[model samples]
Target: MKNLAESVNIEAAEIMKIFQWKGTTDQLTDEEKTHLKYEIADTLIYLFYMCDQLKIDPVDVMKAKLEYNKGRHWKKDKE
Candidate 1:
């Protein structure tokens, strides 16, 4: 699909392929790590493409989003 949103979902699905039926995905296995890395790069490529298409600065938007997230109450690790 030419839709950027669709492209994002497709790329995300590709990334998720490595994690399918896998447990403790937070700790990716060596093999899965490699595959995930490539998929993540693919996703980022599409993301950058979308940014260019929209005439938006990805870095600036990311920084602003991070700053907005900083004010959320989601901090503190489970102890």
Candidate 2:
């Protein structure tokens, strides 16, 4: 479980490289775009694996969370 969570975060960080966070770089190259695709897939794969390993129903959890969020009052702060 811990490994999967770590993998998900690592892959997300890898994907973030394409976006030039904190003025680090320019746009993604063709190769970096390809890497972005793979990283996103990796994140999802780890997430699915973790859910299966925990015997958790992702669909149900997602729905429940969505419903719960729908009932909550919220606002996005101005940037």
Worst ten-residue run, lDDT, model 2?
Answer: 20-29
Backbone clashes in model 1: 0
Task: Give the alpha-carbon lDDT of every model.
Answer: 0.85, 0.83
- State the RMSD for candidate 1: 2.9
lDDT of 1 at 5: 72
TM-score of each: 0.78, 0.70
Q: Write one digit per residue (lDDT tens) for candidate 2, span 1-79.
A: 7888998888888777667554555666788788888989988889889999999988999999999998777766332
Query: What is the C-alpha lDDT profile of model 1 across 1-79, one tens digit per residue?
Result: 2787788888899988888877783677898888888889988888998999989999999999999997777647433
Error of 1 at 58 (Å): 0.6
User: How close to the true structure is residue 33 of candidate 2, measured as C-alpha lDDT?
Assistant: 80
